[model samples]
Target: MTDPSQTPSLDLPDGVAVTGALKPGYEQILSRQALELIATLHRELEPRRQERLAARQEVVRAIADGEDLDFLPETASIREDDSWRVAEHAPGLVDRRVEMTGPTDRKMTINAMNSGARVWLADQEDANTPLWENVVEGPMNLRDAIAGTISFTSPEGKEYALKTTDQAQLPTIVMRPRGWHLDEKHITVDGERTSGGLVDFALSMCASATLQLEAGKGPYFYLPKMEHYLEARLWNDAFTIAQDALGIPRGTIRATCLIETYPAAFQMEEILYELREHSAGLNAGRWDYLFSIIKTYRTRGRDFVLPDRNAVTMTAPMMRAYTNLLVRTCHKRGAHAIGGMAAFIPSKDEEVNKAAFEKVTADKQREAEDGFDGSWVAHPGMVQTCLDVFDRVLGDRPNQVDNTREDVQVTAADLLDVKATPGEVTEQGLRANIDVGLQYLATWLTGRGAVGIHNLMEDAATAEISRSQVWQWINNDITLTDTGEVVTQELVERLVDEVVTTLPGDASNYEEAKRLFLAVAVADEYADFLTVPAYEEMP
Candidate 1:
C-alpha cells in the first residue's frame, strides 16, 4: 500500500483536494490551471449534472409504471427543423473512414497510432478502469502520444514505439472521457467527489488540446452513455467553457455523441442540434444500445427479452431500424454517421482468422453500403480490414454525409421492435454470459479493462450486456431452448458457481468477481450500471 504521508502535494485550486496520491509526473497533468478549470466547472455545473442524473431515474421509474418511450414532444421542433446542421467537420476529422479504439496505455497508444486507422479512440470509459494510477497516466500517455515521444518496453524485453517513418499516417486522437454518471472519488470539490467525466475532460484538454490543435486536429471527443438531449447540452456547455479557459478558439472541440441508450436513440436529432457547433457526428454504440433495451424494459415482459448476445447481430431487424434511423438523422442534419464496433480480434489460428475476417469484412461492407461514413475496429490487425471496406465506398471522397438516407423512416414502434429480433435463448448462451461476466469483472477489478477473451475484445459494455441479460432472464423466467429448464435465480447462482471453478486460478480477483457479479446479477433490484458499484472496488 502507498504511504499517505509520502504522497506529493500540489498547489491545488480553492475548494479542490487531490485525495488521490500524486506521482512525479501527475502534478504536470493536474497542474494548477487544470485544477482551476475542474473546480470552476464543478461549481458551475455540478447541480445540473445532479439534475440530469435524477431525470434518468425519473424516466426509469416511469418506465416501470408502463410508460412507453418516444421522442420528446417538447423537442419536436428541433427535430423537425431541417435547416440546422452541425458545423463542418474539423481538421483531421473530415474522413473518418476507419477508427481504432482501446485503453490509453503507453503500449496501446503507440500501437494505435501506428495501426493505420484514421482516428484513434483513446478510451477512458468502458475500455478503462479508473484506478488512481490510470486516471493520471491515461492523460499522460495521450500527451506523450501526441508529442511523438511515447514508447514502451514490456517486462519480457519486447519493445514498442510509434512509427516515425510515416508521420502523416498517424491516426487522429479522439479521446472518450468517462460519462456524466461517474464520480472521481479521489478528487473532491467542497467535500464532494468531482465528476469523473469532468476530471478526464479537463486533464486531457489541459494536457493535449493545444497540441492537437497545432497538429491540425482540434480537441476531439466521443461522448458515451448519454440518455437525453439535455445531457448533450451539458457537454456543449463544458466544451465552450473549457475552450475559453484554455484560450483555444471557440468551436475548436468537436464531439460525436454515442446514441447507445434507448432514450438517446429517440433523441438523436435533438442531440445533434444541441451540440451542432462542436459536433463531429454520432456513432452507433450497438452493444450498449442492446443493454439499454434490456435495462429500460426488463420488467415489461417477454416482448422485451432479447436472445443470446452473439445471436443478435447488426443485421437484425430492430438493429437495422436503430442504425437506419441514426444514419438518416445524422445525414439529414449534415453530420457524419459512424457505425458500431467490430470487436473480433484476429488470432494466430488460421481457421479462426479466416472465418472472423470474412464476418468482419461482411459487417464493414454492410456499414459502408448502408451509408456510414466510417466504423470502429477494436484490434490493430483489423484496421486494414475496416479501412479497405470504407476505401472502396468513399474512393476520392472524404465521407458519405450527402447520402442522407431520406428513404428511411423509423417510428417509435420500429425502434422498439424487440420482438422482431431473431434467435433463441439457449443453455450454452446462458453459460457464456455467466462465464464472460465473471471473467470480465475479475480483470476489471484488477484495473485492466480492455480484455481479450475467446478471440474477441471484451470491454465493460460487453460485460454489462452479459450480466444484464442474465438478470433479465432470471426475472422473466426465460427458458433455455436446448435444456427446457426455466432460468431461475437458483439456476443462475448454480451456473455462477460452476463458472467460478472454471476460471483461471492465477487470477486472484475471480472470488471477488463472483461476489460482484452476483450482486448485479441476482439482486432483488437491478443495478443501473455495474461499473458504478465496481468503481468502489477499484484500486
Candidate 2:
C-alpha cells in the first residue's frame, strides 16, 4: 500500500485528494479539469452506482431464493417498440471488421495501432492491472497515442513507433474502462474512493476526446460487466455528463456494452434501449459470460454446473443462443453486433500455429455467417485471419446490420440450457483450472493483466472462468468423468500444491497467488470478482 504522506500531492479540485504518487507528466493526465469532471460525476452518480450494485446483489439473493432470471417486464415496451434506433456510427467505426485489444503500455499502444485492425480496443479493464503507475500512465499513453507521438524502445535497442506516414491507415481507438464494482483507491473524492470506471472515463475524455474528434473520431468505449438495464442507464448518464463537461456533442461518445453477465443476456434489448442514443453495439464477451454463468448460478443445483472452461465453446447450445440473440438484438436496433475474442497467439512451433489458426478461422467464419459486424483478436498475427473471414462475408460492405436475423428465435429456456452442452469433466480439466488460476493470479499480482498461458492469451476473464469453475464444481459435488473422483476442497488444494511446483521460477508473486487463488476458489461464500479482494494486495 502507498502511504499518502510519501506521494506527491497535486493542486486538485476541491474535495479531491491524490493518494497515489504523481510522476512528473501525470499531472497533465490528472489535471484540474479532469479531476473536476470525475469529482462532479462521482458526487452526482456514485449513489446510483452503489444502488445498481446493491440491485445486483438483490437479484443474486432472489435467484438463491428461487426466483427465475428473465427479461424485465417493466422494460418490455422498449423491446416491443420498433421505432427506436441507436445513433449513427461515428467516423472510423463504421467498418470495424477486426479489433485488437490490449493494455495501454507504450509498446502495446504502438503495436496495436499498427496491427492493421480497424479498431484498437485500448483496454484498461480486464487487460490492465490497475497499479498506481498503470492508472496514471494509461491515460498518458493514450494521450500520446492520439497526439501521434507514441513510441517505445526496448532494453535490447529495438525501436517502435506509430505509422505516421499514412495516418489514414491507423485503427480507430476505443477505450474500455474498469467496471462499477471497482474503486480507484489511489484517488479519493469527498472522503470516499471514486469509481475506477468514472476515473478512467474522465481522464480519457479530458485527455483525448477533442483530439480524437479532430482526428475524425470521438470518445468511444467498450463497457464491461453490466448486469441490468439500469446500469446501462447509469453509464448513459455518465456519458452525457462527461461529454457536456468536455463540450463534445451530446452523443459524441459511443459505447459497446459487453453482454457478458447471465442476467444481462436476458436484458440485451433493454440495455440497448437505455443507451440507444450513445450505443455502438453489444459484444459477445464469451469468457466473462461463462464466468458469469458459473458465478450467478453457483448456488443452484448440479443442473447449472458448468464443465471445464475449455469444453464450453461458442458452439454450445446456450452460447449459440446468446450470440444469436446479440446479433439479432443489435440489428433490430440499428446497432453493430460484434463477435467474441480469438485469444490464440501464434507461436514458434509450426504445427501449433497451424492448429490455432485453423480454430480461429473457423470461429470467425461462424461469427460472420451469423451476421456479426466484426470481432476481436488478441494478437497482431491473427488480425489477418479475422480480417480474411469477415472480409469474405462482408466484401465491399461495411457491416451486415441489415440482416436482422428474423428467422432466429430464442427463448429463456434456450439461454439456460446448460444441460445440453456436450463435454465431460476430467481430472486433467480440473488440474488445468488450478494451474491457470494460480498462474494468472501470480502474473496479475506482478502487474500483468494479459498473460500467455499454454499458448492462449489469458486475461482476467479467463482466470475468473478458471477459479469460478473450481468453486462451482466443488459446491455442486461434481465428479470427474475420467477418474470418478469427486471434486472437493482437499482435491483442489492438493492440485494447487502440485501445480505450484511446476510454475515458472521467475513468477515473483507465486505464494501470494497460491493463497489468493485458494481463498476465492474454496471460500464458503464465493468472491464476487477475484480482482476486488486481489486489488487490496496490489502494490
Off by over 4 Å in 2: 1-9, 165-167, 506-509
| Runs in model 1 lying further than 4 Å from the true structure | 1-8, 165-167, 506-509
User: Per-residue alpha-carbon lDDT of model 2 for 292-315, expressed as tens digits?
Assistant: 988787777888888777888999
State, as a TM-score between 0 and 1, how close model 1 is to the true structure. 0.98
Give the per-residue lDDT digits (tens) of candidate 1, residues 304-380.
99999999999888899999999999999889999989899989999999999999999999999999999999999
lDDT of 2 at 265: 99
Per-residue lDDT, model 2, residue 522, is 89
Q: What's the C-alpha lDDT at position 136 in model 1?
A: 91
